[model samples]
Target: MARVLMYTTAICPYCVNAKKLLAQKGVSVEEIRVDQNPQLRTEMMQKSGQRTVPQIWIGELHVGGFTDLWALDKQGKLDGLLQNN
Candidate 1:
């Protein structure tokens, strides 16, 4: 399984859905609460080039957010990503 990291807020619906989906895929996410730390949010933006809650990374691969994740899953690409790392 790949190491999953997510930049998230305390109360985000997309984050919640993203977590739920990752869980359903049998992934345990390392969640960084950007809402609690502004610096982390800045880091997430710098890392992903996207200022959004639930910026996810599978190992070194930036997976964007919930919609991008869902799209990957739909394309049957997510499992391959997880398996690679």
Candidate 2:
């Protein structure tokens, strides 16, 4: 298993859905709530180049938002990324 980091806001539906999907996949995540932390939000944007609520990183791979994450899972690439080989 790899380290999962997610930059998320409190009221984002996509963030909730992303977390649920990750839970279903049995992946433990470290969530950073950027809604209250401006610095983290800025860091997330700088790191991912996306001004989005859910900025997910499976190890060093930027997995993008909820839709992108789901696409990876559907393509069966998410698990491999999570394994971080």
Candidate 3:
């Protein structure tokens, strides 16, 4: 499996959904709660170019948030990405 990192905030519905979906797909994600750490939030924005909560990175690929992730899954590309292929 690819390295899955999520920059999330506490009480974020999208983040919760994203996690659930990834879990359902059998992917274990490393979650970085930006609400608890300002530095991580800055790093997330710099790395992803997005200041939104629930910024997700699959391996080295910036997969965006819940909407982007679901779109990839809908297109059947998420699994391939998760496998790092």
> Highest TM-score: which candidate?
1
Indicate whether candidate 1 or candidate 2 has the larger TM-score.
1
How much lDDT does candidate 3 score?
A: 0.92
Runs of candidate 2 exceeding 4 Å displacement: none
lDDT tens readout by residue for model 3, 2-73: 989999988999999999999999999899999998998899989989999799989888889999999999
For candidate 2, list the clashing residue pairs, or say none.
Answer: none
Looking at candidate 2, the ten consecutive residues that score lowest on lDDT are 76-85
Task: State candidate 1's TM-score.
Answer: 0.97
- Stretches off by above 4 angstroms in model 3 are none
Residue range 15-59, candidate 2, lDDT tens digits: 999999999888988999998989998999899999987999888
The alpha-carbon deviation from the true structure for residue 58 of candidate 1, after best TM-score superposition, in angstroms, is 0.4
**What's the lDDT for residue 12 in model 1?**
98
Candidate 1 wrong stretches, greater than 4 Å:
none
Top-down TM-score ranking: 1, 3, 2
- The most accurate candidate by lDDT is 1
Candidate 1: worst 10 consecutive residues by lDDT?
Answer: 45-54
What is the lDDT, from 0 to 100, of the residue 78 in candidate 3?
Answer: 95
